[model samples]
Target: MDHDHVRDVDPAVADALEGELERQRSTLQMIASENHVSRAVVDAQGSVLTNKYAEGYPGSRYYGGCEYADEVEQLAIDRAAELFGAEHVNVQPHSGTQANQAVYFAMLEPGDRILSLDLTHGGHLSHGHPANFVGQLYEVEQYEVDAETGYIDYDGLEEQAAEFDPDIVVSGYSAYPRDIDWERIQDVADDVDALHLADIAHITGLVAAGVHSSPVGIADFVTGSTHKTIRAGRGGIVMCDEEYADDVDAAVFPGGQGGPLMHNVAGKAVGFEEALQPEFEEYAEQTVANAKALGETLADEGFSLVSGGTDNHLVLVDLRESHPDTSGGDAEVALEEAGIVLNGNTVPGETRSAFDPSGIRAGTPALTTRGFDEDDCRKVGELIARVIDAPDDEAVKAEVREEVEALCAANPLYEDD
Candidate 1:
């Protein structure tokens, strides 16, 4: 983490890199889509593989001198298949969005219909948001979570599918806390004779550890980011049965991207190896436990938790009901000032703009990676409530900052650095 060579070349960039490392070490990283990767993964990501260009899958590349590249990419593909129990795997997409793009390009035509969850109700932009290419390229329809229960309205989704008759039905979510019924979504897709794409970008590690229900065999295509819960550096993966393997591979390579990020593929290989260890399962279980503890503590402090709690790694807090005056953006800024890092998120039935939504989303993956337990998460929740309760109070923020420093000291991150 010293960045000695970087300092010798460019002192300013070196300072920023060192500062980022220190920031992660000092603050509470509770962002749901973020996690801390092991040093081995970091080293692999910074490896000399970055200098190489592997244009195609293993043993079938268009370029020469791809011997080592073939080996590393095949290792990543094999490990990901073992972890997810998929017949075929592609580890080339630069991100989860690109992974989704591959699936769309492989199976969809221009003007084909796509039905997915709404962005404000726990969906992703790649699913069908007008701002993204997917929305622009396809005829898109959206479904929502039940207003009363704060859960996906499966029945409503079924009806929407019947009317929209989509070519593909996208499942999985971003901010929703409850476990998804993949079979139910698959049934809807089946009835419509449509393909199902399950994006588990937020819970790849949890699924790998058998802590979350997998959609590998059930959905037509399963896609995810290698980071997030997996801590597998930074990349995206797509898994499907062998029948669609060639289509997915070609779509990922020639259709969406050219040369894969070889260094990131190396990182994924290392991180996947690390995740196969028994301890990673414990880490996954503890991450969910910590999220539950955090939600309970926040609920006790009078913060309204969406869906009443969480089933995975994150808890979504709707601030409009409890703290009518404080916006999620307001709480986000104040919490950052107090060294607690999380995001202001849009709730199910969002009343405010996405920029300053009514909710805050927090998770426990990074904290659990740093050896935090349920009790530690509860204390962190209390600190969050305090900051949210009096966002404008400098004295309260100062006190919470001190407590945050103590927590960081107790549960050190990147200590070896």
Candidate 2:
């Protein structure tokens, strides 16, 4: 991870880069939408492709000197298509938000109706939060997870879709933990003659590995972040049937962005190649297993889990029931001090502000990438429970920090450094 070239050019930026690497090595990154990419992916993202500008798809570039860029981009596309069984893949959007934007741009016009999950109920801002451009552009109506069950109410959504008569229906989620019934959502869209866009940004790898059901074939459009559970470098991807391939490609390129980030495309290619290995399936399985173990441990410690459990790599713990006085932010701060890192998130039926929510969201992707298993995750959960239960206790914080350090040592990340 040495940045000798960057150090020679700008020592300050180099120090920050090295510091970030150190921070990741030391902390437990349980942020639900994040994961650690392999060193190979890192290397590819740091390659010479960053200097190239390929503004169009392979075989049809707007610039010269795109032969290598074409190769890398094509590799990414091929690997991703095979991974998800998508008829078409556009690995060009700069981020997950942009991926969603591409879908909207391709399918809908200004003021067209968009039906999506409510942000506080585990949906993404890009889906239609007032703060985002999509919300400003589209007439948005939001659905919600069941207050009592913490799952999507499909029948309710169907009824809402019929009433709203939206131009597009967005499925998949950001913070919700259970497996989605893509077909149910798609059926709702179909009945209303609306387009279905499934944003699997958080579970790209899980879907690819068959641990979660995919929306590639069922939904009209599918988009995801490459960096999350997929373990690619930072980027986004869009998949659709051949019928909409040109539209998606155009939307991702001239509609939303100019040149493709070829370096990130290279990283995506390498990571997707790694995911095609037999071991990655085991990794996906272990990731879900670890989440279950962590959630169970938290449940045993009196923490109320959303949905009472998880079917994926993430678990959302609502603190309102057990620790009425402590906000999710309060627990987040204390846990970080103890070397455990995760975010405070808005839970279903949230009674607090988004800035300081009632629940903490944890995920197993990064820890699993660092070789953590069910036992290790359970131990981490125990540490989390301790901190949340006694956030002001210095003695408990110290003990938990020591244990976190031991776990980090046991599963070393980037040891070459």
Candidate 3:
């Protein structure tokens, strides 16, 4: 869409870009946290709003000439608030992690206890990773999904809540593949006199489209990424109860970040407005359907799925029986050779290092956005099976890559308008 920039790119770079586009059009993108937004979102992200320096909210910016920037940002906040049914929204935090940071600053003190799902058990890094500020400043206790069923243990969580008496109970996941029973977590938080938060970063689009349950009313604070299923620009939002509105606003501005990314905010506004359309609901539903189909097909091919399978848009493949000598590390490389890009993830009790694990995570949002569905997803499963069956054979990888190209030709990304 930004033709001038594309033209300025070196010839090799341009060719590589074209090739990448071809690959994206062809292969399956089953990464749950990735999606394809419309040209409107792209345009707004590249707009002149990026030049502004609006340090504060509309009608009260820290700098002048932010009149239009303030208008667009406020519209984004209002639209997102309406979409998620939240009483307050802040479309500032540069990423989901920062959104969490602002919430912590607004509500809790340092060293407050935070009860969250364990990272390997489907929790995100910012929730309580030792390397992150969260683990350094707060007392962190983790809850786990039932190893056998791969689901949350509400009873166990309540017991821990009673024992830990944490100050915050955060309900969310990066890869559990099950719907969160946020109401139960809310109850546990209330019994323990803790604030409840939901990090709905991965499922915000599904939540917005009404295909999945939302935590707007259930949790006191909700954090999410605009780029994930929300299909917005690369940024984050923090939504909360009306009572915490000022606290959240001040925390984001003076307490955490400064000089907001006005261009990204404009893009978020366009993305939120697009999300409010009826077609967006259809897109979310289709993405879930594609994910389910892909998961079932892969399972039928004798690949064991982590947590059985996903209830949402991602599936984690356990590569034990398929490649006993290799981890998801090797499998991911093999798949990449075939033009499929996804990340290897650590499944529960994984013995391998964090960089190279036993499981590969895949999802459907991007491919579904490109209009691929059940039939196309099944074919991708077959291709993945082929690649896994011969992870080291260059010929096999090349052959599957060709197949991927053919499949992509059938469903090009961004069909000509």
Give per-model TM-scores: 0.99, 0.99, 0.95
> In order, what lDDT does every prediction score?
0.95, 0.94, 0.86
Clash pairs (backbone) in predicted model 3 = 26-408, 30-362, 30-363, 31-363
Give the Cα error of residue 66 in candidate 3, in Å.
1.3
What TM-score would you give candidate 1 relative to the actual structure? 0.99
As a TM-score, model 2 comes out at 0.99
Please give, for residues 1-417, the per-residue lDDT of candidate 3 as tens digits.
324477586767777777766656667666668887788887899889878899988899878888798799889999998899889999988999999989888888999999998887789998988989999999999988776676788999999999999999998778877777889899999999999989999988999999888888999999999988888888999999889999999999989999999889988999999899999999889878877888899899989887787777888887775667878888888898898877788777667877888888888888888788889888888888888888989999999989888777787777773
Q: Which clashing pairs does model 1 show? A: none
Candidate 3 TM-score over all chains jointly: 0.95
Residue 400's lDDT within candidate 3 is: 90
